[model samples]
Target: MMIIKEPKELQQELKRRRFEAAKQGRELTVGLVPTMGYLHEGHASLIRKARANDVVVLSIFVNPIQFGPNEDLDRYPRDAARDLALAEKECVDIVFMPEVQHMYPQPTKTKIQVEGLTSSLCGASRPGHFDGVTTVVAKLFHITKPDFAYFGMKDAQQVAVLSQMVADLNMDVQLVPCPIVRESDGMALSSRNVYLNEEQRSQALVLSASLKEAYELVQEQKSTTAAELKKLLTERIEAKPLAEIDYVEVLTFPELEPISEQTRLSDYEGDIIAALAVKFGSTRLIDNMLFQKKDVALHV
Candidate 1:
């Protein structure tokens, strides 16, 4: 796999590939998987999906802009050699690992914000977090210019914000949302999982378990009220001694508007996402599940 550090070099390579494919009388499909460096099975799942394209580029830049002042920026995580090995194993064609300076040689003034979508959930807690995410992702899309970009459903809000940005701005890339990859015990795999101690790790199961309970409530019991669902989730996490609730929200998909108490589950068509962020010690983790009324009714 080729390791590209400079933006210009990466752009030049992509242009060359495009030209070569055009010369062969065929169109090239490039898939991009943007990440913040600590490679895991979740990232590998994205890589595997990207492998379907003729050219796959995996970016491993730990974006400083996306992190807040009090957030784990300096100590997020990094293992370049390990990440490169994983990229190679996943058959990735190019790994773009750019330095902060390389990405922002001289940042003056430019921020991409997805407005309403960023106003709630993790956005409410983190503040300017989604703005940083959208800005860097927009930069990456412009530099990589891939035909398709892949993201995990584990970050349901991130996916929602970026998807809106793509549509609103008329970006050329197709955003591909992949399923969440979780551990056997149901904790959604995250790079930050390394920060969890043995005890904290065990307690962390509450995040997923709470979502599972919410799913059962809606799918099995046909419980349609958002208030009851959020209440159940909040209580489930608060019961875990190590877990501290950050946010428990049930909202409509894509739109991401709050599910009103008046809105019945059976009456709402399309997808609904139950997302939450909780802290097990100082390590903050997030997870979400997507539900469709038809699928829920069928199980009932």
Candidate 2:
């Protein structure tokens, strides 16, 4: 219910709330849901999960550091009023929406880099992007001091990288990865979805469509190789003239290492993530499905 702007103020307020709860002989647990200013069902799902904790703190800062030089930092969609209303609807206890200057009083010299995870997927295409991501999220973890932090699995690579950072640094927070919330038609939810025109929006479904088909093929034991899976995804998305392929990667989940081209789905012993990033008329949309190998077959 409270919207905090200053970092110190948020820390003080959380401390005060913890103190009050302690006096009542109740231990306080804080949950943090970090996001940019646009609120969608995907973000709402994260807040709902955070609500399990005693206090749900949502930070809606569109981190400038995360955006590359040519990326859409300037054009990133934002609706503070709508976001705040949604937060209120979700019963969020605190909304930490800080300005760019407040977050970075001066240019930051410190950067947290998790090496291998940063070399592929979105990181492969956008250099220094994950550095920005890790740096900003680290700042948020320090500022909010939450016992648990919630992130959507749509950005699975991010979950992997941040998890590494947390473990490596001994940070005292549990990273909760939630499922990808999608439209009825299967298009993954994203704030950038606003940039899609009618035509592009319709064609964008190919991303999810391809992923769904890929998931089925893996599940049904179609006897396909990793290379074949990538090709199938590529061909399907390429069928949509408007869809431009950024990367269609079939990599090991969390590890994100490349599976050999000849490696069949059945032979793979761990979790696999088939991720796609495609651009449709200046708007880039990403969708992926995790294939977990339980026994002879893979389950999504």
Candidate 3:
């Protein structure tokens, strides 16, 4: 994989990638996967599939504008050399690791906003997080103008928000959402996995287990209300000594508006999504599952 560090050099590389493909009279499908510097298996899975099907353009930019006042921008782990090494193994054709200043100019003010869905899930706790994410991803998309962009399903609400943003903005790219990569235990894999101490690691299972219970509740045909299910999740998540429940709520999919009424699968086109956010130690984690009313009705 070629590492393009300079902005002008990267643009020249992109033009070369475009011209080389055009010479063969073949449509070059470039799949763009955006990430912060530190890379992991979860990110590799996205790139692997992108490489199998298209020219993979992986970007590593630890965006600062996205970080809030008290957030972990200063402390977020970063290792560019390690990230580039992994990108090569993943069959990524081009890795664009831009400096923080290259990604943002002084006196920049514009931002990208995804309505409704961003207001809930992790959005509720981290103010302006999605705005930063959407804006940076938007800038990358414009610069590379890839045929497809990929993301992991572990960030369920982010997938929903980006899907909405692309449709709304009429951007000419397919946003591919891949499944989440999990630990042998049920905990979802994340960059923040580094923060968990031995005890905190064991306690973190409660978050996933609580979501499991919520699904079980829906399975038992117990009166399935979003509120009671969320309550069950909150209680289980907070059982850990250092864990704190940020928000655990059942939301209707796509719109992601919090569900208040008794929602039936038939009513929602089989697109209801359960999402939650929790803080363990100083790290915040989010996870969700997409389900249909049919899945609830068929519970064994």
lDDT of 3 by residue, 227-276 (tens): 66666777787777788878777777767876665664334554677777
The 10-residue segment with the lowest total lDDT in model 1: 291-300
Candidates sorted by TM-score, best first = 2, 1, 3
Task: List the RMSD of every prediction in angstroms.
Answer: 2.0, 1.8, 2.7
- What are the per-residue Cα lDDT tens digits for candidate 2 across 84-135? 9999999999999999988999999999999999999999888999999999
Query: Per-residue lDDT for 280 in model 1?
Result: 88
Stretches off by above 4 angstroms in model 2 are: 294-300
Worst 10 residues of 3 by lDDT: 291-300
Q: Quick one: how many clashes does candidate 2 have?
A: 1
- The alpha-carbon lDDT assigned to residue 153 of candidate 1 equals 87
> What does candidate 2 score on TM?
0.97
Candidate 3, residue 210: how far the Cα is off, in Å: 1.7
Error of 1 at 300 (Å): 18
> Tens digits of per-residue lDDT for model 1 on 1-300?
999999999999999999999999989989999999889999999999998899999999988887889999999889999999999999999999999999999983899988899999989999989999999999999899999999988888999999999999999999999888888888899999999999999998988888887878776666558888888888988888998888888899878998787666766787888888999889999998788755642110
TM-score on alpha carbons, each prediction: 0.96, 0.97, 0.91
Which portions of model 3 show Cα errors greater than 4 Å? Answer: 220-223, 264-267, 293-300
